[model samples]
Structures are given as structure tokens and as C-alpha cells.
Target: DCEFLGIVGRNGSGKSTLLKLLSKIYTPTKGDIEIDGSLVPFIELGVGFNPELTGRENVYLNGAMLGFSNQEMDAMYDDIVKFAELPEFMDQKLKNYSSGMQVRLAFSIAIRARGDILILDEVLAVGDAAFQKKCNDYFASLHGKQTVILVTHSMENVMAYCDRAILIEKGKIIEEGEPAKITEAYLKLFNLNS
Candidate 1:
């Protein structure tokens, strides 16, 4: 049941659209899409964050949206802050936080939230290198333990984390196979298109 799948393609090639469909943020206009488990989507980080609210407050607010009760959020609150490396900034208003700070907090919540599947869109591109390494290590650990659907342009990421991958072009499946082959084909698309 655990599978790490990557969707790779050029910009505007429906990679994000596919994630939306999977997360039910967009219903497919055509075929039936079925998902067997609950999904926690990190499609647009900081989407629901409020500028006026303190980070601590927003954490609780966002946790509620994910269907976590106060007790549950309380249990996870420390880990979330710890992971985001924002322990000192939690009481500060979100508007005062830098863009990097905001994204780290959002990413932390997405990873820590309980769900059967994780839907991510360019999430690894965020933060500084150290944080990115943390993220990479986290995904590596989840390799055979979690079902993750990642939409990314980083061929390195596809090669490193994906068990399987699909290359999308112009809103269609161009290829589906091993991560290495799909990434190689994805790179070739640039030469062919140009």
C-alpha cells in the first residue's frame, strides 16, 4: 500500500492540476478518480494562514481545518514547532514572519498531520539547504512507510525518492515507468520541444 510516486513535467503541463484532482481541490471534468484513503495535501503552503493571527493561533486554526481536535493538536503542537524550528516565533503574528518562516511552518504541519496519503507540490523547493536536507531525509524515511504523491521539477528528487513516476506533457501521460526512465524522458522533452 505504501508507494512514493512522482509527477514530473514542464511548467503549465498539468502537474499541479493532477495533484488538485487527487486532493479533490478540483473534480475531474472527465474520468472517475478514486482514492482509497484520507489525503493531506500540501499543494499551496500558507494558503490558509492569517496575517493578523499569531503563529500559535494559526497552527491551532489550521490544525482544526485538518480535522484535528484541540487535544490532538495539543499533542502535536510541540513537534510541529520543533520541526519547523520556529519555537521562538510561535507567539508572533504571521505577518511579521519571513516568507521562509511561513513556509516552514506550513510544511511542518503537512508532514506531521495524520493521513494515509500526502499530496505535495514543489514543497522541497522551499527553505534553505539545511531545511531542505531535513525534508529530504524525512521523505527518504517515509519511502516504504507512506504513500506520497509529489509534483516536482527537480529530477534529482524524482530519482532519489520516487519508487515510480509518470511524466506528463500537455495535460496527458507521456510516459509511466521507473523514476530514472521517466526523469530521463522528462529531460529529453526540453530538447524535443525546443
Candidate 2:
């Protein structure tokens, strides 16, 4: 079991597409995918969110979409709000929140959900530097305990967090091995060196 696998590739090189396929957001044109356990995907910002709804309401809505009960959401509510650092703004409509705030709330909710495997796409692109460090710490904490499939372009992130990695190009995996090695090959694709 690959506990933490990072995917790295250039833009439009099918990295996000691969994550989408794994998350069931898109069906593969051909071939099949077999997943052995429950998964949580944080593919896009505000995916299951309604802009007109209050942040508190959206939390419950998102939890429900993830197969969580109201009681479960209630139990996690405080933690989510605290993590997002937006407890005061929970009553406000999501549309009124800044993009950063919206992403923070969405990410907080997503991370709270239980899952055997977590699929993330460009999650590191969210929040400010301080919040990004929080995200880094959170991922660091999950190092050996959780199964994560991450899509990112940052070689530093790949080297820092991943146990294994793959380089995809044109919808096919061209390299797979240690994070450092995969990242090296990814760099060469763009005439850059690690």
C-alpha cells in the first residue's frame, strides 16, 4: 500500500486528470480502476458548496454529501470552525467570504471527514503562507498513518512529503519511483534541474 504517493507533471500533462479519475470525477475513456477502501477527494474549490448558503449550513451540507450524519457533523463542527479560524464568520453566506476564506473552510471540512484514502488536487495552492504551513504540518502528521494521493507541481513538496511518486505526461505514467527520482525526471521535462 502506497501511503503517500505524489504525482508531479507539467501543466496539461494529465496530473489533475489522473486525480479526477481516481476520485471518480471522470470516467476513464478506457481501462478500469479498482479502489479497495473508502476515499475522500478534495479536487476542486467549492465543489459541493452553495454560495448563497451560510458557512455553517454549508458545513453540514458538505458533511452530508460525504455520508456523514447531522450528529457526526455536530461533533466535528467546533474543530472545523477552529481550524478554519473563521468561527465568527460561520453565519455569513459563502459568497460573502473571500476566496482564501472559502477554501480554508472547505479544506477544513474535507480534512475532518473519515476515509481510508484521501485524494487531493492542488490543495497546497490554498491559503496564505501561514495557513500553508498549517496544511504542511497536517500532512506531515499523516505521513505514515494515512493513504494520500497528492497532485502538485512543487518538487519541494514531493521531496518533503511523499514516500513514492509518479510523473505523468499525456495521460500516461512515464516515471515511477522514489519522490526525488520522479521529481528529477519531471524537472528534466522542462529543462530544469532539481
Report the number of the highest-TM-score candidate: 1
- Provide the global lDDT of candidate 1 against the true structure: 0.91
Q: What is the lDDT of residue 93 in candidate 1?
A: 99
Candidate 2's residue-wise lDDT over 1-194, tens digit each? 64889998888889888887888889988989999998888887668899999999999999998789999999999999998999899999999999999999999998987889988898987899988999989999998899999999888999999999999888789999998799779878889532
TM-score to native of every candidate shown: 0.96, 0.94
Worst 10-residue lDDT window for candidate 2 reads 185-194
Candidate 1 residue 97 Cα shift, in angstroms, is 0.3
Colliding residue pairs in candidate 2: none
Give lDDT per model, in order.
0.91, 0.90
- Each candidate: RMSD: 1.1, 1.9
After superposition, candidate 2 runs with Cα above 4 Å error: 192-194
Query: What does candidate 1's lDDT look like per residue over 1-194, in tens digits?
Result: 79999999999999998998888889888889989998988888877899999999999988888889999999999999999999999999999999999999998887767899999899988899999999989889998899999999998999989999999989999899999899889889998896
For every model shown, the clashing-pair count is 0, 0
